[model samples]
Target: MSKPYSVEQPERSAVDAMDGIVALEFGADWCGHCKAAQPLIQAALGAYPSVQHIKVEDGSGRKLGRSLRVKLWPTVVVLRQGQELARVVRPADEEEVRRALATAD
Candidate 1:
C-alpha cells in the first residue's frame, strides 16, 4: 500500500510509461500546501490501486514540475497511458482530490 506511493525519481522511460498514471507535484518539507495534500493524495491512491501514483518535488532544480507546467504547489496531474488526462492545482481537501481522480477516469 505504502510502496506505490513512493516517489519515482525523474526519468524519461518511467514518466513516459505511465499509462493510467496519477502524477502528484509535491514540494519539500517547507511547502505547507504540499504537506496538507499528502494524506489526501495517499487516500486517493489507496482507492485507485491500479493507478500509478508518482510524486515529484516542485522546488528548484526539479524540472518535472516545470515540464508539467505546474503553476501551483500540490498539483495533481492525472494521465491515461502517459497522456495528460486531467489536473487539479492546489487542491483544498480530500473531496477535491477525489473529484480530480474521478475526472481522470
Candidate 2:
C-alpha cells in the first residue's frame, strides 16, 4: 500500500522538499467539515505530489495559523517557493484546489 499522505507531526525539514506547498487546515478532529475535507485534500494533492501537502490543526494554540490569518476550518492555501499563491475557504470542488496549485509560480 502507498504511504498515507497525512502528517500528524510534521518537521520543518520535511516540508522543504516541496517546491510548492498546499496547506489544508483546521483546528481539530472534532470539526465535521475538517473530517470531510481530508479525503478530498489527499486525492486532489496527488496531481501535484511534488508539492508539499500539509494539514495543520489550527488550535493547538500554535502561532502558524494565527500568522496565516485563518478564520475558518477547511481552508486550503497554496504556496510556491514559500509564498502565497491562492487561498480558498471551504472549497466544494477539487478543481479549485487543482486550479490553485496550477497557478503557483
Candidate 3:
C-alpha cells in the first residue's frame, strides 16, 4: 500500500493485499450528503466482509481527496490492487455501493 500524503487519511496500499475491495469515502463531517449516506453505506458494506472502508475527512488541504479529484461530498471510490474500479458520488441507492464493491471482489 502506498503511504498517503496526509496523516488524516489511510494509505492506499493498506488494501493492496486483500481480496481487492477497498472503499474510500471522501467527505467532511458536517456535509449533509455524507451523513445521509452513512446508513446506506454501512448497510451495503455489511454484505461485503472483505471490503476495506476508509472514511477521509476531506476539506481544504486534504491531499487524498485532491489527488482523487473529488469535488463533492460522500464520494466513494472503490479500488482494487491500488487501482480504481468504481466510484459513487452522493449515492441515493445502497445497491449502487453494493454493486461497486461487487466489482472489486
Score every model by TM-score.
Answer: 0.76, 0.72, 0.83
The sequence of per-residue lDDT tens digits that candidate 1 reaches over residues 1-105 is: 133223445664567666566555455555777777778778766777777666665656566766777777778888766677678877777777777777766
State, as a TM-score between 0 and 1, how close model 2 is to the true structure.
0.72
Model 2 alpha-carbon drift over 4 Å, by segment: 1-19, 22-24
Instruction: Give the Å error, residue 27, model 3.
Output: 0.8
Look at candidate 3 and tell me the lDDT of residue 97.
87
TM-score of 3: 0.83
Best by TM-score: 3
Q: For residue 5, give model 1's deviation from the true position in Å.
A: 9.9
Off by over 4 Å in 1: 1-8
- RMSD of every prediction: 3.1, 3.9, 5.2
Model-by-model lDDT, in order? 0.67, 0.63, 0.78
Which of the two, 1 or 2, has more lDDT? 1
Which lDDT tens digits does candidate 2 get at residues 21-95? 655454456677766666666677788877766666666455566566778877877765556688877767778
lDDT (Cα, tens digit) per residue for candidate 3, span 6-97: 23765545545556567888877777788788888888888997787878888877777777889998899998777889999999989998
